[model samples]
Target: MNAQAFPPIPFLDLKAQQARLPGLKARLDAVLAHGQYILGPEVHELEAKLAGFCGAAHCVSVSSGTDALQIALMAEGIGRGDAVFLPAFTYTATAEVPLLLGATPVFVDVDPRTFQMDLASLEARIATVKKAGALRPRAIIGVDLFGQPADWAGIATIAAREGLFTLDDCAQSFGAAQGGVRLGKAADATATSFFPSKPLGAYGDGGALFTQSAERAALYRSLRTHGEGTTRYEVLRTGMNGRLDTMQAAVLLAKLEVFEAELARREEIARIYDAALKDVLAVPARMPGSQSAWAVYCVTLPDEATREAAKAALAAASIGHAVYYPRALHQQPAYQPSHDGAALPVAESLGARVLALPIHPDLSDEQAQRVAATLIQALGG
Candidate 1:
């Protein structure tokens, strides 16, 4: 195939996102004129809008998604031998924050289909930890994987029973909801990212934390800026430098205008992909009464060999594809201790077969159709 004949589709197209930038230039230019780049007016404006969108009382903007998690943990005072339960199937950052805070990340299996934390497994893990009488069960981090909100009601119920704080990792499912309740409002605190490729991305790295408690929100603000209570020099608590930049905040504020439209378009694209690929692959299962943001349109191939073959075929046909995570976080080098002597059949299996297809607001119907056709053809469906 001639490269010019069919231009390769990318997993994400930031250039297409750039075309929407002009709408915010006037607001951005005004910020530039004021020369107040850090903690500027736009920062509060974006935070307020995000808090309203998530139906939360407070939103604290931070430097990155990783920082958002770190701040949330700090605000909750989860540290020093505290045990934070997390799904073993998720990204490393979900578990890393706990370790960084001198806490232990207790790995739990995920629901085989939804790829979210398995509530039964989570409760079992918590009980086992308590029985051990060594580690303290302090919190649970429920990740909204592939843009679908986790079983928040179930997870939250378990957390409340165990007196554990819940942090909703909305990094991929910021706009998602279950039973009309948004992800941010589902947990004690919600953390989301704006890592350029996210559904509501900024120009660069950015993230925000949402909470309903006034005291927690105030603490998070202090944690984001090196724990300053009143003055910059006064350190009330140990904290990280996690302030979000003004420029990224400005870009996100502009992107917020069309976020709902883009979410709807993503859903349409996902439906098309699901219908076309269902016969050949295991399509993502949408839970009842839940709406996903569809951050990634992922499918599970029949096996590892078929997954590799399909990826090669997509490459040959100029279709874009990626593996959201080829390796489970528990299997990573840094998290070896957590995975030691643990057997997670579902997480390991999904890591071998899951593949993400090109999905974004910019993907045209024709492109989506082509991606579907190429996958089916590759799999000999």
Candidate 2:
């Protein structure tokens, strides 16, 4: 095939996704007519729907994914002198929340292949921290990296035994599940993002926290709005402004109609990539009893050099690709000081080898095959 005959395949085609926007526009128009943009009726409706979808008793909408994490941590009373266990392979927001609340973020390594938190590494880190007598182990922020759910059952058992709270960072795994249990049900509290590219996304920044405990849910609701117990004017505790916009809720409601269909499409696309690339590259593993939302189809090259060469080849071929986390969180400038010289070999290694291929629910079958073929050729398969 001639290079000129094929145009570049975007990393994420938001314009292709826009074909699903008409229904959302109608919902937005209705929301505008009602003129309750703050926390309108649609917000409550969306919260109820999301709570039911995730098998949680309550869902509290927040302004952004980061806000959801902060509110959940605050509701659990994690503060100064507390330490939150998290995987260093994840996005900065996972650790930033703990730091913002005056708590410490203890970095742990991830599974080299799965790219999820390594449970053994987590235990080791916990033991190291406890032995030091420097901080209290307050919570474990289990991130569902690359849209795959973490080892929640294993993590939950460990948290229960250790007497620590658990929060599922479902920002990238909202629709994911394991052993018939959804992401929200796997942890003490689950926070999910509605960023435009997430499986169940809104038009703009939006997020929600889910929990089974009504008391905890109530506290989160209050904490999201300046910690108001009775009214907005009466403050019971310190809180930040973290309410999700009603317009976003309206858009999300419309998108929810076809969320399952989109998820199915994403799974199909991932399977296609796997079938085409598995022989030549290290494909993502779907652990037994787990279902990923397929937010990204990431593959690992033989080494850093091969990864770089593959990326350049794809670019020259007009095929888009990206490196999700070129640098592990522990190696990042802001987090390096807190790591106390602890090393995360797996995360550091995978940071150099992992590459995210063009993937999205709206990605075309032809485009996916072309991407896989291009990657295979680039990798000299």
Candidate 3:
């Protein structure tokens, strides 16, 4: 079938998802009816559901994923000269939160195939940081980039050996799994986003933290609510106004009713894309013993020029496409002064070759086929 015969493709069809969710309006209306806008019953309900969904002992909902990261670090007393190791090839938020807290982010190179944090590079960076004596290796923020689980087993071993805290940046990979277990409890603390575009999104900015330790859970709760020990007037420690809104919690509850099915549908779409593009393009590699949330289905083009040409061609065909990250964290102008002039070869080189395609659950087989065929045609197949 000709790609031109298919309907217009959207990079993310939130409207289609909304259409599937019949109870969404009612959920939102309930929030409006109730006067309590902040940390209402819905918020607690959503937290419990989320925790149970991932088998986490507790869930601390927050205003956003960035705040979740900051609160987690704050709970650990990570500040000034503390090194928060993370991948260079991910969204800026992963690195930004560390700098916001006055902690230096040590950029680690990523795997060429998986686009995950390279364990070897992470260990080497930790060693270098210790040798320099300028910074203390406090934590490792292992990111589940592009919805696939990072090598948590390896990260755990390293963190244990080095006496570092493990923070799972599951901002894009909440529904992802490893070794048959879900992501929320993979690290000492896991933070996930509910940005409108994430795999499991809220109507607005929202996030949560997962932990097994009762003390950590209590600390997170207090940190998120202005450090109130027992009463709102009694301040125990410095904190932020990082509470999840009741309305957003309501929206998530409705979405959660169908989340598992939606996740399965995303996998089905990914398989279609894999079968169609793997022969001609560098499709994403499936990591062993894990499942991706399928947040973004990216492909590697030959080079910068080829990527640009393909982007133009996709535009001409009315097919939705995008570039995940045009520059690595170390290369960004804002972080240049902070970067230690480390040569992250794979991360630096990746910006020239990667392109993202439409892979939302809303995509039908015909639309996915059109996307795949259009890309192949764009690449001069």
Candidate 4:
């Protein structure tokens, strides 16, 4: 067989997405003509559209997803001596934001099946934190990992019982839903990213914060713009330069027009993978009464060695494969000092066994089938 016979598949097909969104050029052109590169009309337009899309009362555009998280925390006055509980089996941004704000991150283990933050583990961590008396239990940063909604209802119960503020780290799950309710208004505040590879991505870095509280919304707007009160010169509080530029907003508004169709296409591709690969491996478990954004299609092998072998097979087949968070956040070098040496076995296991396959709207059913076939052969199934 010719090695060149295998077609290249992108893990994130941004070029194909661009081609599908024809209004992108026009949106960008409008921004260019307006000459208001910072916080222009497009920024407000994108914010309104995003808030309306998710039923959030307010949406404040930010420079990036990380900034969205930071801004949300700052609004709540979460800082030194406070403990922010979050899942271990997630991207670094979730854990990093708390630590950056001079608070400690309590790394809780995730549920083996759903891969979302385990509510039991979360409750236990809160109790332990209160018992230890080292830090104040201030907030629960519930993450919707890999485009799935964290059991927001369960998390809400835990947070209310413990008097902790809830922030939905919805970076990968902006379009996702739980019990038919969209993600943005699930928590007291929700933060979403528009990084180029995200389901509703911009041409460059962009993000938005959604909240129902008008006061928090005003605080967020002020904080993102150097803490300006009524005027730019009048500083209300210490803040960061976290404004979303006009061009990215323009690009996102254009992409937002087609986001629903793309999400449907992604769902169709996930079904293709599930239908072909489910019996052979541990396919993703569907959460009851929930819809995933399908940002990643991950299946676990028996162990690390098998996962490595499968990755090699994928590479040989010219298919893109990745391991999300190859290490739990607490296991990383920087976090070792803060991590209380708590055992998160499921998080550790997930880090070793999970393999993310090619999943994006541009993937054809035939290509998805090819990926499944290659993985099955690699597993000797």
RMSD of each: 1.4, 1.0, 1.1, 1.0
TM-score of candidate 3 against the unseen true structure:
0.98
TM-score of each: 0.97, 0.98, 0.98, 0.99
Question: Residue 283 CA error for candidate 2 (Å)?
Answer: 0.3
Superposition-based RMSD of candidate 1 using all C-alpha atoms, in angstroms? 1.4
Weakest ten-residue segment in model 3 by summed lDDT: 1-10
Q: Report the C-alpha lDDT of model 3 over 1-381, residue by residue, as the tens digit.
A: 454666778999999999999999999999899868999999999999999999999999999999999999999999888999999999998899889889999999999889999999999999999999999999999999889999999999999999999999999998999999999998999999999999999989999999998999999999999999999999999999999999999999999999999889999999999999999989998779999999999888878999998898888888888898999999999898889999999999899999999988889998888888878887777
Models sorted by lDDT, best on top: 3, 4, 2, 1
The C-alpha stretches of model 2 lying farther than 4 A from their native spots are none
Candidate models: Cα lDDT each: 0.89, 0.89, 0.93, 0.90
- Top lDDT: which candidate number? 3
Candidate 2 on 1-381: residue-level lDDT in tens?
455789878887777776876787788898889999999999999999998887888899999999999999998889999999999998899999999999999999999888999999999999999999999999999999888999998999999999999999999989888987777878989999999878887778999999989998889888989899888799999988999999999989988888888889999999999999888989999867988998878898878999998888888888878898998998999988888678789988888899999778877899899888877777777
How would you order the candidates by TM-score, starting with the best?
4, 3, 2, 1
lDDT of 1 by residue, 1-381 (tens): 333567789899888877876778877887899888999999999999999997999999999999999999988888887999999998889999999999999999988778888888898888888998889999999999989989888988898899999999999988998998777878899999999889999888999999988898999999999899899999999888999988888899889998998999999999999889888778999877999999998898778999999889888887778897888888888998765356877888888999999989989998898889888878887
Candidate 1 stretches with Cα past 4 Å from truth are 1-4
Q: To one decimal, what is the Cα RMSD in angstroms of model 4 from the true structure?
A: 1.0
Q: Candidate 4 on 51-109: residue-level lDDT in tens?
A: 99988999999999999999999999999999999999999999899999999999999
